[model samples]
Target chain A: MATLKDVAKLAGLTTSTVSRVINNRGYISENTRKKVDDAMKDLNYHPNEAARSLRMKSTNTIGLIVPHVSHPYFAEMISNLEARAYEKGYKILLCNSQCIHEREEEYIRMCINHKVAGIILCSGSVALDVFDGVDVPVITIERFLDNRTASIECDNKQGGALAAEKLIECGCKHLLHVGNIGTLSMPADMRTEGFREVCERKKIPFVEIYTEDTQYYRMEYDEMLENVLQKYPETDGMFVNSDVIAAQTLQTCRKFHISVPDQLKIIGFDDTNIAQLTTPQLTTIHQPVKEMAEIAINLLNDSVAGKLVAKRTVLPVNLIERETT
Target chain B: MATLKDVAKLAGLTTSTVSRVINNRGYISENTRKKVDDAMKDLNYHPNEAARSLRMKSTNTIGLIVPHVSHPYFAEMISNLEARAYEKGYKILLCNSQCIHEREEEYIRMCINHKVAGIILCSGSVALDVFDGVDVPVITIERFLDNRTASIECDNKQGGALAAEKLIECGCKHLLHVGNIGTLSMPADMRTEGFREVCERKKIPFVEIYTEDTQYYRMEYDEMLENVLQKYPETDGMFVNSDVIAAQTLQTCRKFHISVPDQLKIIGFDDTNIAQLTTPQLTTIHQPVKEMAEIAINLLNDSVAGKLVAKRTVLPVNLIERETT
Candidate 1:
């Protein structure tokens, strides 16, 4: 309810004088600044943001887009990015696309229209063409676009290799790498490349499982993996692409009476909260999501300041051995 | 790299004309709009946000403060709030306080300085007196403040009562309500009242196991509950205050070889994603988080437009049945 006019009138000064003090624009006496501050507290004056944003071209905010915040991947990314952005005195506009491409574009349009300092993309299949020739700086995590657009991704290839190596060390013979590794779905490439390279070097027979092009969350891959295990009971080792996949595998393994780390030395990616929730706490490869998110926010901030950011940034991954293998 | 001057020069107009085009203000011809749009696209223009914010007073964005985005309870709230806010063409500024009072104050100050349209407090433990004379409209969820301020919360009494009735129906002789009830740490008075009321009516003996004042999360509470179970082995039916708590109860029960429904039927609250993640699934109370968020935004929007809003908005809660009960 308080207005700048109220504070100015109470301070017995011109509104422009009050404005200068609040915005710290023009020179004003220290005495007048103190008077204005006291009057503002008394009047509870908050400079109208809607009005002020019309003059200041930058809101000191960034727009963040993700597929699902409840999902471990996005949740961790959001917390990490939020802490980092706050440290830089910047706020984050969180957008949950719910894994829809159109929703992702909707947020992008809003970010452009609002003139955010930077836009960070953490999820959704955002096409590079959409950002082609766009004016604002765009940064992607786990997804990459045109050359100007920067990217921060986990070394999924390394994660894949780690899981494979762990499974083999656990004395697994027959292995089944159940996941979709294609061009459209971004990180699958690094993971599949790593998994395949390790399998080839080990001279062990491996089977591949692919799903519908749209199954980005691995929900659709659950049933397919169930069938794979049923069809190949001799498969002693399973390298799951995600923690959620490994969780579902535990449930299915329970149904089939397949013991984990005994009959199935399963290794999952993304050490999400669910990784620990599963029955045989999933042996997972931990993606440095928090570190990556912090780095992404910094990179976006630097780019907004017109600093050169690396075209590609890769985060590390670790194998957290738990109950399952 | 394009500036307002460049756009104006290319459009054969003044700098104010380009500013008006970007702001969507004043009377401008459709032809002029088209020409400005074309010029902006051709020149790859991005109007600086700070300059615009200086005039607008409000940024057409809302600030959301939560404890942690990685937790299921807050993550669900974030996802729900983002979905609803997006539909209303409002963006969100995320602030994770980690349940620290100082961090919450920092977020509040940041929101005020940035001049966001309004703020939504998803996690609150701050003294209501601290925000007594603030200028902006703040809506708190699951936390009550001064009578003058607005709050959107689930009918906690009903949720507690619902949990009690379900647990009683499961045929347990003696039961205990697990959570920090009415303590400043959690301040979950509704659950406490609901369980006490139901027990009094049924003449069934009940005990309260309040965890020491500490942070609330699934993993942390799981360890606490494990200790509580050892102290009160007679506690057969549990009216746990959260789904994450219930998930841990199930895991610890497994560790102790206490088969649920057979030995200890459990009922949790807040039907978060963790409900599905838990084995035997958790039968919990459903809080309409998305609708609550939508109302928070609408109430703030009305306040900005100089309209009255309800001081307290209470939505209905439901009992979702699963294996736990």
Candidate 2:
């Protein structure tokens, strides 16, 4: 195992200064910290946990709790988060909770027990009881609760408004909204509220189709889309829940001969890679994932450094016009 | 910091039995081992590495090296490999080698220094000269590197033959195969060779498009597919290299009024999830990913457990005909 002595030798720093930098004590300059961390990563050195505990105390690592890393949305979010966190010189230990809220709560407790610098929660926004109990700094994504700590998210209301306005401008008179909105999820509420407000403002008639349950992410969604299209044959424009749903909706539309942007103008949210790979492509709302991830990591860094984090960090959203709308 | 004593106490076992079970040294029964491991996982018990080193002297973890996990081909492979490895009681530490020879070399060295039980080389069919120096068991996927250790893969030539046969059955006459054929890679050669040989048997003229260098993996393939269609207006069949390329081709066909299976018959290799999600769906060769992954992990585990590995395991492939054919 490489020690502080070897790291100091490689970083060209005195043992005391290396200790100061690693420990975040003795008022060491920022340059020394970079040199020390670069040397450590190069050396593939993991400081002894007990020894570091006795010396500097914290490992400066943050744990990110995501439901699944393989899903497109979470994968894109994690890629952005990883890039931003790597730029900030923090190593991320990603835990795939796999939608088990109890498992997510366990990981949170585990990170706290391991003295992780901070925690970023992205899995379940419905469970506030667990997050409220967390004593350490917690950064959230796409949801906020009780004005605790920090959160970075795109303006979901603005995103929903953009989708509504685009579909309206595309001459979609008979409109329908398809989504799963059974829970008190903040982002969902914001989006639906903005959508309803826009419809009221325009005095356009619209119908909302809520998916079966609050737990509906992507399981059995292709069937649900088929049913929605079959039930609403006269619907001209549909603002489906996500890009995944929008892609499936387009497939269903083709099955029923509802030509897109002519007979039907469809819009989705998230603007993930799946949106681009669609045949006509997707005119969806773009969540500033990279910027939000960067902000989340920055807030975690600040909180870990014993600085105050902003109550809410709001990023902008934009409408990406492709072939769908 | 729960130790063997805590775990054994919780599981109603002696510390020595728990230690033996964890180390896999002595003849502890399976029932006892299962009980001990369950208790450990339940109580978040992590074993002492140094203590295990003094006894068995090997970390019971394997390193899985892949090019990128975001790609559907490798992502499906990783999922299969992880499930197989986890079933065999081995934790996989993923290393994304980015398909660079230097990165592969570096990760091999990293795996060695970390004393992982074995390494599963998925991306790079590493040169024998590079791995001959490493003092660990290596399992290479998708290759038959003769005179080396164990290798397990699906039959690529048979898969290619099936693809050609499917397209031919769809009444495709003027067809083209898009892939690579060179001294460096064997899979692409096998596929193209199988395709050409079949076309020769049928006395049908065929065109070949090759991807140069690492461009086969990520080459902005939509434009390439469009260019191919533009060049070969009479072409009615496509034997794509992978499922991703096939998906892109399938999506591109919709733009030109070229209906899949009606005007053009397309066959994709690697029956990944994307194959089922495509609009017309895909008739592709299923490369027994689960069986191949299980055999690879089995070879690695058998080698690490001081048992002889089955040399040059070959699994079968099948053509799944869906709407595309």
Top candidate, metric lDDT:
1
lDDT of 1 by residue, A82-160 (tens): 8898767577888888777777875776677666778888766776655655576788898756665589889988988
Q: Report fnat in order of the candidates.
A: 0.63, 0.06
Per-residue lDDT tens digits of candidate 2, residues B1-325? 6777899998999988887776666577778977996787667675544334324445555767776656666766766776676556565556666566666665665565445678888766677655554556788787545455587778877877888887887788898888763435754468887788888998878898876545554535787889989999999999987877888887789888898788999889888766766677778888888788888888888787788888788788898888888
Candidate 2 lDDT, A160-199, residue by residue in tens: 7888888888888888987555653656557777788898
What is each candidate's DockQ, to 2 decimals? 0.41, 0.17
Q: In DockQ terms, which candidate is top?
A: 1
lDDT of 2 at A194: 76
**Deviation of model 1 at A86, angstroms:** 1.6
Clashes (N, CA, C under 3 Å) per candidate: 37, 0
Model 1: docking quality category: acceptable
Residue pairs clashing, model 2: none
Model 1: lDDT of residue A232:
87
For candidate 1, what is the TM-score? 0.82
CA lDDT, every model vs. true structure:
0.77, 0.72
